[model samples]
Target: MLSSHCLNDDPWNKFPFTGFVAMISAVLTLMVDSITTSVFSRSGKEEPHADVASAYTPDQEMGRSHHGDHGLNLSDDKELGSTLQLLRYRVIAIVLELGIVVHSIVIGVSVGATNNTCTIKGLIAALCFHQMFEGMGLGGCILQAKYEWVKKAVMAFFFAVTTPFGVVLGMALSKTYKENSPDSLITVGLLNASSGGLLIYMSLVDLLAADFMGQKMQQSIKLQLKSYAAVLLGSGGMAVLAKWT
Candidate 1:
């Protein structure tokens, strides 16, 4: 119920805003990394199922040669590369969407739980900015995924409602919900931690590594360094926002 292991409170009871829990979180994250890596390695040998809804777009179709092509020529390096990029985009997009949706839900719940109108306005503002950037990134990925209209509409709908859904949930529970209760503490804290981990991994591996370590970014040291600086700047901006928000 608590993370306190301190001398007086035996910090194990209320550990949050503490280093011990942070270490445990890191350990948990490490465990997640290892487990996922092992599973991915084992599955790597197996063929992946193809999604017919987003199999290939007209542009991909046009990449084919005039010769009687019995099937897709993945033999063409450029075409193969493009296919890989599209797959990468789709995967990252889904992951990012899930992460942001969870995050929005949490933020919305907090806002909904609060009765102060002034605080609500600030929270709503933050949520808007947060979702705006997330939407831009997710939109680009979905575009690359080339999903059918129905699927795209579904994603858009979920993206639009995630925060509102959470707010409604919070309001519904407000009658009996106790934010200071142990259950609330653990539930919300763990949820935030999980979303944070997912976002971190997706940004680092699915995005940065996939791009920076690719032939494109690897070709020019100057471009790579510039990208690094840009990322650092972005990190600082988020850090400042965290300080206040």
Candidate 2:
């Protein structure tokens, strides 16, 4: 982003120092989040009620299929693993949404600040497909999270409103919010850069890795090949959209 109409525009346009810092910040932020999520998820083991615990004994433990200290039994272990996996997906959804929010805001603000009718029209067309595909991906994650209806609604509501809110904000400041201005360029560029980093990391690590490295995918060569084809097709479509954007 810093390569376009930015401080690095002169001579050979390239990503600037600011972009580097923003990318670094994104990495650090994700690292902290990863540690926090791992610690929290592990510590949040389901505990038996006090009464049940009081009556439980070594004999009771022997009766149950022990899966280490965090309770036993095959069904409960499966359920707990599923719950934890869903929780991880929920975190991914939130993080992915946050990145999308920042990116959507940048797109909306740029659209709002620019007076170029053709640019605005092209953006509007491209963004419709972009948001549609993005929503599909995020919706899949949210569905996997298996949140209650209220939480699902809240997440959907936030994602839906963010871009429009950015457009409104940009319009309110349009008089002074020059898209190419030093302040606007620096701010928007850094945000875009950081959000890009976050999105890339989450997509590769949390989303793709989860699916591609799973037992089902690993066990089926045909499925893996088909999945790769789908990923490439989607990626190619996004690349085309980026060109217009």
Candidate 2 clashes between residue pairs 3 or more apart in a chain or in different chains: none
What lDDT tens digits, residue by residue, belong to model 2 across residues 131-216? Answer: 89889989998887666677789989988988898888878889998877767777887787777777777787788998999999
Q: lDDT score, residue 159, model 2? A: 87
Candidate 2: residue 185 Cα off by (Å): 1.2
Q: What is the C-alpha lDDT of each candidate?
A: 0.68, 0.75
lDDT of 1 by residue, 188-218 (tens): 7667776776767666766678779999899
lDDT value for model 1: 0.68
Over 4 Å off in model 2, which ranges? 5-22, 46-72
| Deviation from native of the Cα of residue 127 in model 1, angstroms | 1.6
